[model samples]
Target: MNALLDLDQLRTFIAIAETGSFTKAAEQVNKTQSAVSMQMRRLEERVGQTIFVRDGRQSRVTDTGLRLLDYARRMLSLNAETIAAFSSDAMSGKVRLGLPDDYAPRLLPTVLASFATTHPNIEIEVVCEQSSCIHRRIQDGRLDLGIVTHGNRTQERNGRIIRSEPLLWVSSAHHSVHCQATIPLALGTKTCTWRAAATEALSKAGKKYRIAYVSSSAAAHTGAVMAGLAISVLPESALTSDMRVLGEREGFPEMKHCDIALLRSENARDRIHNALAAHIVNALDNVSGGAALAAE
Candidate 1:
């Protein structure tokens, strides 16, 4: 009796459970629909349980499949921690990194420059994109590592956080958020952490706001607010520049701190990622020293 549940098959089942459709899961796992179905079948045979109840339009996990998914997530998470723990020694390589616009301008330069100065042998490739895009790329294995904002303390994705920064609402020189006839809003794309929080807070507070400006880049989002187009919420780190605070009412929901994480492949134990992660954590920890040096 084949009793050991296959890890790959379990992962596929988890994806299907999350998506609730085999087509979506197939795309997510980078397998053909038929291949994905075959893997699930084999997994069911090995476990001797019907994991999914499939209909023509949709599929849902049986109680057994749901139970298996919880274990699968833990297995993958532990599998990551195990790698990061042991694979602390290796040569750094061409490290491709993705960062959000605000982070790229604020903390990332110091982090990268320090890493470069320390390990001159490893070449660094950097891309500045929205945090949402960064997470997607990391999951797709298109990049080696990434730094993204954790809007919800989102650990579901395979990312290991290195630094966390608070998110706050900010506006132009003398303006604060007010429940006037209309509150002006400055926002990033739909995927941005700050944008969503700012809007949601307004709605929950029973205030009205119109997006005066929306940009894909966080820098542009902040820039719009600085230009007095509207109010916006952002990580304090994004306020690296001199700007006056406006209507910051205390006790507004604290947006999950912007988390700069090392979003790598399942191979968190991979030598290059481990080295880069260490270098990043160390550099971010020395925030004052690096900021001062960056000033020079």
Candidate 2:
């Protein structure tokens, strides 16, 4: 008999699939391209199935590869948990975190759960507000860390970008607000990046639009769009299954990609903050469909 799938090989396989290029995967895993290729070949042999289809400069994961990817992710997650659980540095302290209402629901639960499991002694306090509010809280030293959206045009930089997704025009699947002569828009307050990007794009396209509804809450924006009151611009990650995306064919202008970043206060130098930040980054990377950018 032979050993089961190697953890290193599985990690490499995931990196390749996530990065979409052997060269990129090599860079990520700190291996030479030839070494990455050797690992893939060895993994394919161990599984007794063809994992990827290679052509010229491209490689596509096969159906078998997709199936293996699921198992690989699970294995790696468990492996990470085991390592974190036994690490000598047991973290304990109160960490205050803030996030935009739109992203909190989608990302906070999983990130907090993972952190809690690994650091049982740590206490986490979360505040969900508008991104602008979160930024201010961090600046005021009212929060230890924050996850906020950075506008494409904002010259002031404060954090590492962990995720980037396209800003999209979304409407109710059952409504035709997009077809209206003057587009009705549901937007957040003036400080919201999505609102600014949406209006700027519309204005540049010479399209006429009116703000039909304004709310700082993500729920309000979603509800307005779902009720056929207006279309709203949102990050692709924030969109729900029930929403329909409007594109150029629907007479909507293209908007810039929204960059979600992590900011830590200058005073947050404790082990708890570092542990929680790592967990948040890993959790987001897992859900970001391999589009999660390396923190910079």
Candidate 3:
């Protein structure tokens, strides 16, 4: 039998599977696209299995690939733990993390789990709030790090962007809210990024809309839409099966992309902060991929 799979190859495989594209996988792994393709071909040859099924411009993992993905994650995790255990400076510090309430449910579990495993001695203090509030806390030095949704497309010097997804108009599948002459909206608080973007898009398109329901909670906005009270604007990642996305065909204006950014304080140079930030980025990647699958 061939020797055990190379760790680097396994890492590359995982990246391709998670990212859903070879170009994206190359970016994640810091390899050329051709190199990544070569690695995948080599991996398949060694395993004697076809892992990914290629479509026109997309690739889907085969059943065999899905099974291998589970093992790949476990192996990489254990490899990381084993290396960290022997390292002289084992991470041992408390980290203050701020996240938006809307993202907590979808992103927290994977981040916390992976960080805890790698840095068992590090204690994570998480605060769930709105993105604007989290940005304020980070700027005030009250938080060591935070994940926020920024309305602007330009990158900030103090923040790193994890991903950017479209802000979309969504309504209840059971409602004809989109057809109303004056659109009724279920929006967030005045400080909410999505609310501001939605209104700006509507105004630019000469569309008339009314804020029919206002709440600070994502659940509340979703509930309002489900109750057919109003249509809501939300990030693509926040969409669910029951929500119908309204596009140009439905007369909805195009909205700007929301950037999911990681903000770090001056103390970000510390090992603990760096480790946590990496974990957060990795977790968000998985969450984004899952959200894409869910939307499909």
Candidate 4:
């Protein structure tokens, strides 16, 4: 039995399995769709196993493919670690990172400060966008890694859960916005999971509400909340002194918890990338400096 596996094909195979779409996998690997198909065929031939099956124009991974996923990830991780271990030159390269705008003010400084302390030579390029946009960039290989809101565990194909925090309903500290008959709300766009959760919670609680403002920017959400225009949903970290938490006692329903995840691209195979990922995970896991909203 030939034990040799082409790492490139394995990488593409991992991409396909993770993304659940050949078209998306192709985009992530920067390959033509045909090229992606050809690579998968070759990979199947090499393994002598059927890895995927067509399901109504969609590619579904076979049992063998699911089994291979673990091996593939281990192989790639070991390969990258081996290369970095023996490399003579110290780690120094540019790593692209993406995250939602809301996280930058609180998350960026802490993460960058710690990482930079040890890896000053490596350049970190940051891009702030919506969590969905950041996820896409990581998939498309435009980013080395990203911090994103992990909505559904089953739907999040390629990311590690880093932090979990309660999603709180908040309004201006000095305002009576939450007292309105029809509770005015500021929230993310329609596609945002947070927005969906917020609306769903309101409906289930039999509360009347109206979307008074919609924006992807955290600053915009904060602005709406601060000016007493509307109540908004925010992660525990993003809370500020000027915001007051709303809960069942205040006639607001309990919101779902928000999870923060670290998503890495297939291109993130170097020590620098790994280092940054580790730092981010560590920083977030131990984070403590937000408005102390936890009830005693």
Candidate 5:
């Protein structure tokens, strides 16, 4: 007979992969380090596959582990949903959620609506800010959860990657601004990862550019781009019909992929928090090639 895959072991495995530290995973799952290791060993035995390999001091997930992750998440989500549907005790509490305005327009509707329908008793307080601000709030215990852009090393250390998208050089479809001798740019504040990527790409390509507008708001970037004031770098989802992507043929270098991640506060361990986070992961994980004018 085939061995059964235990839900509890899969839960521990997820914590380890997301936290990227055995000790941290142990803490998150309420298990001792030795117990966590023992559970992983049993999990490997059941599956007959090596899922983890040591990298320096960290245990990195193997390719097989990565393949298993999607199924694990789906299974856990369904299990939680099923339990919540029939449980005598319904979950209720306030969850402080944070994310940039860029994502709010697109991601907020779906995630909020779904969560509200299933966990009606729960209240959610949302904060819209830049990725840096969201990370600070998560670390400071002011926010229960955050969906943030992956760029800062400090933030990435504790972040669980949820999605990735291409970063493209975008210009107004009706404008020839990208062909200017000194390219005009509309970008986020100096601290923004997208801005850093855009400037670095231009500098490396030996292209001259000027910062024409600076704002942390995606709407502001849209305004600048639509008015033929400047070109900007945005995630593929953030592009609108009025915008066209620029590339190497247009003298723009290819930018790096943008990673979106979920960050949870240390104090958020209750059932309500877990439910909301899981709901968010499930909702966002299924979004692919969605056409939206939202930002990171």
Candidate 6:
């Protein structure tokens, strides 16, 4: 029996689904439109039915195309696996992992220590940056994996989402700002997920505010906040004796938590990648769970 499809045809189908046009898919895949059309034809012939339903400008996937997308992802993933399995070398190579800044306070050291114990030969490099930077590094293959924030992961290469937890407002114990005046605020740069969440919530609530302290580092933000000059937002686990959550400051916005993802490349089907993902997931779950217990 002839194989039902080739890798090239499956990839063309995914491009069509994503781009919604044979012409666009052809350009994206660097094939002629006729070639793309012929590939779809051959694919349909193998499956014994049509895979796409064309209506004017839009090309919607038929029931078959949708099912085939899942297969395509799995196929491509395994294809990647087959290449990596043979290509993988001694695990002595370093693993470059990216992380978000705020998450580092409680999560980073634990994860690194555990991974070190498991893969002592493999050196680890940690780069702490914003969530967007982490995602870009993961996509560009600069970071083998990352503990990124609020990233939307797809089935094939979207990476694994590990934790989602609420971040709360943190202020010095002596905060006296009322609901009427501008509240002194401490926040990281504009690209920060937690900072954006807090500012957007404040804008929606029409709360008067001013950035009393802006810092490049989370430690700096915490310092200004602890000095009783500004208030900052952080994960609840970041609490300290000098800092506490504001209870009566009124008009807390409904910012639904942040997602912290344990992401790796689609190419990370190697044993090293699998081991790292497992260890990181367990560490993050324990960290979040243990923090929740402490908060309670």
- lDDT: which candidate is best? 5
Summarize candidate 1's per-residue lDDT along 1-296 as a digit string, tens digits: 64886777877776565444566667667899898889989988987888777555445577887787678766755554455456655255687788777777756655675455345456778888877787777778777777776656454355666777666767666555433478777788777776777777777876667888888867677677766666677666556354554443633444556666667755445666777877776555444311111100
- Candidate 5: residue 66 Cα off by (Å): 36
Please report, in order, the local distance difference test score of every candidate based on alpha carbons: 0.66, 0.81, 0.79, 0.81, 0.83, 0.69
Task: Show the lowest summed lDDT stretch of 10 residues, model 1.
Answer: 287-296
Better of 5 and 6 by TM-score: 5
Q: lDDT per residue, candidate 5, 1-296, as tens digits?
A: 29888988998887666545666667667899899889989988988899887655545678888887767766776776777778879897899999998788768865775567467678999999999999999999999999988896765678998888899999999989999999999999988988999999999999999999999998899899999999998888777788999999998999999999999999999999999999887667544332111110
Off by over 4 Å in 1: 1-92, 153-157, 174-180, 247-256, 267-270, 288-296
Q: What are the models' TM-scores?
A: 0.60, 0.70, 0.78, 0.68, 0.68, 0.61
Q: How many clashing residue pairs are found in candidate 5?
A: 1
> Residue 228, candidate 2: how far off, in angstroms?
1.1
Q: Which segments of candidate 2 are over 4 A away from where they belong?
A: 1-89, 152-156, 288-296
* Cα lDDT tens digits for candidate 4, 100-195: 887898877656754664565678999999888888888899999999999874546567889899999999999998998999999989868799
Cα error, candidate 3, residue 35 (Å): 2.9
Q: What would the per-residue lDDT of candidate 3 be over residues 97-173, giving only the tens digit for each residue?
A: 99887777767755676567557778899998887778778878889999888655333445788978888899999
Which scores greater on lDDT, model 5 or model 6? 5
Model 3 reaches what TM-score against the true structure? 0.78
Summing lDDT over every window of 10 consecutive residues in candidate 2, give the lowest-scoring window: 287-296
Best-fitting candidate, measured by TM-score? 3
Better of 1 and 5 by TM-score: 5
